[model samples]
Target: MSQKNNKKRPKSRSWRGLFRRRSDPHRAYREKYLETLQYQHRTFDVKGLTTQGIFTLELARVFVDLGLGQMGQRPSTDPIPRFAPAQQRERHSIWEYLTSESLQNHNLAVLGAPGSGKTTLLKHLTLTLASPESLPESVQGMPRMPILLLLRDYAAIIEEEPDFSLLTAVKQELARREENIPLDWLAQDLQNGRCLIMLDGLDEVAKPQLRRQVVAWVERQMQLYRNNRFIITSRPFGYRNNPLNGVLVLEVRPFTPEQVRQFIHNWYLANEIKSAGHDDKGVRLDARQGAEDLLVRLRQTPVLLDMSVNPLLLTMIATVHRYRSSLPGRRVELYEEICEVFLGKRHEARGILYDLTPAQKKRVLQPLAYAMMLHKQREISIEEAMAIIDEPLSRVSPHTPRNEFLRMIENTSGLLVEREVGMLGFAHLTFQEYLTAVHVLDQRLEHELVQHI
Candidate 1:
């Protein structure tokens, strides 16, 4: 038996000089807060591959540090505009430039299309900042307390508490670990130019009025914490109306063929290393061979290869290809397979059941997607969404409660996403477009669609 085993779960951690911007008077609480951030951001949560026996991958092990550039000026989802390939010289490696002094000195807004790795980049920065040992050159001697916040959470908080400021949010974030931190600790840090403020997913704010408030709030914080580093992320369209002044806009460039190859190699190698649980020589040759096979398949198929540039979709392709050993050549077939992977395969793997079948899940969501496209809204409130989905649900799942269907769809299917409190939307814009087109064709709404066009 073990020796009395009394470790009491675990605290965050103890790190030497993690945020060396200055000495902390409240060392205990500060370290605890930093540890929490480190734990939360230090892993890549890859989904839909549980059957492959990989649920979480280490952030440091597989992170590829995809470059940033002026990939495109618009957020349009058209292939050319959204995913313009970047030449080597035109982009800056995230490994080299992410925490460079020049970037740290100025505020920045990183915009990218859906699944283009904007959030991943922020999380990478968070994880590295949390653990400076991982990025010695990138973050050493320039450590700032990495305060990462999701803008959606910010919006939700402020809506309930009108007096909630960024300062309050940070304090609350720390307080959640414990209330031992002095009230002046964060303020002193902010005053002394010692914080890296990262706000992620501006597009997820959903409501326009609340978005305006969030932007204004950010602007206010930038002014108040004039010396601290700030980085905000969003899709290009979400930021077009109220673009911040003096903040550099860097678009997340898609993975070029070379980067794609590197990511594939890294992903497989990392998985093999994790599965084998050792680093002995020849522990796993499967990673090297499997990466080659996946790369070959992508190289042979133009559409799949083109889709490989986007990191999230490419990751899905890699996971799905590994399990299935083949890829659908057509974009439509690929989308259908993605839906099946998310809606059916995921739940099947977990032995979970729902009232609606995979096809019926799509059936209920098609009209909602059609309505969203018709009105030019990517997200709808839960009430409005339930109302729109009511008719479709009645047709497919009359016995199922609407809220129960919504809950199952959110939990099991993974196609419907809640961007924020009381808000719902499709996980991807491409999914919405495909479902909307299906709806139009099935209902013979060509004339109505043509009129709108």
Candidate 2:
């Protein structure tokens, strides 16, 4: 009996030590979490065409200043009222703005137009929060676990079964990192203001009714888990009023000229690093030269300057300029050329083979674009999208399965992107709007053209 009790004592001590380590939130555990985050996100996760390296540093370097301002008039297609309650605002970096005393207790609603770097900014914050090496002075020594939840994924779950808990999602995510803190312990941590919850893409919830539910869920979470920091991101037109009582609303400012120059330089430097590892030294020199040339052209062209304010568009411009040595002057021409390149030249360079001509591809896409416009939806489920796509596809390739063709398009065309398991949206809202405009032109709706423009 004495020997058995002695054996159990050591085993009990080991078990207790395990719980102790899990309960102790410190720098060592935080380092592990940061490693996991960096691995999961990687630089390829950036929106649009994936830049080759861990360009998080580049993103941070080029990070534009965010400003407070009255919600300006949005595009006609997106008529949702501004959500910010105040008229006065100031510009600040993510580090400076988020670390303020005013925002410590209040949740933040970050609103921007599509392709305006809202998602990228949130992701950069997440990576920074997790990484001790990159921690800004404001967030340094702040022992908080940053959990990023995609609102679309949460909404999909909510739509399937209304009883899904956000805590469950958090638990599953933490489990990925082997940090399975008890639910009650996690809740206590949140209530104690030790967690940073980043809810990304509130606008990505496709249905209005569904989005309202998500908004309500987020509000409930904020209220229930009081004192925790939360940053929720959404497009300008998709945002409604403050769902949380003390939420701070912020808008991502367009990139300024100097910021654009910085981004171009960083972008090429990162690409040069990527090329140096696998390609000839000449490739790196060419990349550097191309970036310098592009910057000069951007300064010379006012239209491109105005368009390049958008990070996504700027990246595309850089990409096109690298290969083609010129940019289209008109917005419509740019989109049209981009579409053709994505369908043909880009795919060819990547060694992907596609049999459909650009015209046939456009024919198949126009119907879906029109459908999205009619529905006023940015994303749709696979079932409905396929149903809408089947007719046009059947006419083009009678024997091909619609699902197979849809996969081909998704795999090849960077324009249409899969957001979640069953949801598909345009890679950027600009693409959707441009395609819709193309459809409208094909229909010769002159009055509607004025309205759309």
Candidate 3:
């Protein structure tokens, strides 16, 4: 009887082992999904331009120290000791400080103006956490998965489901990314403090009501997912009310002269490698000359320096300077030149010709710009954008098909971008503002204001 029982036990165990060996479709899908995500989001898509650069966040972040108090001031609870060690007084990257803390109770709000490298910093952080090899010494060996959620996308989700939550939104995002991760697995990871949530672009929420909801949702997420780390980003004005509680607010500092110089050097060095041929020496020489010229301009002109301190503008300056061999003297002139470059000259220089002239394109875009400004919108639907082009298209070129014209504008014009499917926004907020300013001036609003004053 004992021998028979033992034999039955072995058979049952073998059957169970065989069942386990069978392939799990869900598990297989998850493994492939992770690989795909690692391939897709492992690097920053610099400037959202076809001419992209691969830069680590460590290189992009300016090391500015902050005291943990109100609006970057000294902490209320403590005073600095006069004889404190030099190391304690030294500056550190916000990234370093953030990792050093007990994140279970900590949340961070990173505020910066448009084109101020906020997104870039977030991207760097995501990539670093996502890719273990890129992790800093302090965060190394930590078991965590970084999930990056564009708040604009999250706001849209909340609109669809009034009862939506941060975790649900994250699950939706993972699904969109084609990741087949199970909710149980995600919940386990979150509960174990193995997740870093990076919520980017709170400012991109176009509506105030929607933005406020997003803020509330974020604050709730911090409480609910108390074990995990969280970082939220926004433009300064967008976060004026200080919505998130128990949060450290850190502002991204403008690039200093030395940092700017280093950036230029790195930019040229990276680009020169791509442009190099058999004569590498000539490419290097030209790159050095370009960097030197840009540095000289930044040093000599305060206005130019002011513009160059922001990474987006500086990158554009570098891009324009690389191709054009000169920068416009005035700020408006620079924008105008940039507009023209995007409209026609950039394509022409690349030996591609679009049918629309720069003037015709400008006429078509001006009314759209004006509408966006009047409505206080940063993004527009494709249908609305086409309607905007229709009025100008009729006046400038009556024969132009609206669809064809819109396609051409999107393809050749660097000024406009398709932020998501069926949606569009200016390449940068600054471009939108510049175009809106031009529209206002053209309408004689400046003269009317002066008269009223």
Per-residue C-alpha lDDT of model 3 across residues 108-191, encoded as one tens digit per residue: 787654455666666656555544434456664333466678887668677666567766776787778777566665565577
lDDT (CA) per prediction = 0.69, 0.62, 0.61
TM-score (C-alpha, index-matched) for candidate 1: 0.68
Per-residue CA lDDT of model 2 for 325-391, tens digit only, reads: 4464445656776566555444344333456765677777877887787788889888888899899
- Pairs in clash, predicted candidate 1: none
* Best candidate (score: lDDT): 1
lDDT of 1: 0.69
Q: Candidate 1 deviates by what RMSD?
A: 11.8
Candidate 2 vs. true structure, TM-score? 0.62
Write model 1 residue lDDT over 4-38, tens digit each, in one string. Answer: 32222112122345345456567655666667787
Provide TM-scores for the models.
0.68, 0.62, 0.59
Number of backbone collisions per candidate: 0, 0, 0
Off by over 4 Å in 1: 1-25, 47-53, 71-73, 76-89, 94-104, 133-135, 141-143, 160-162, 174-184, 328-334, 337-453
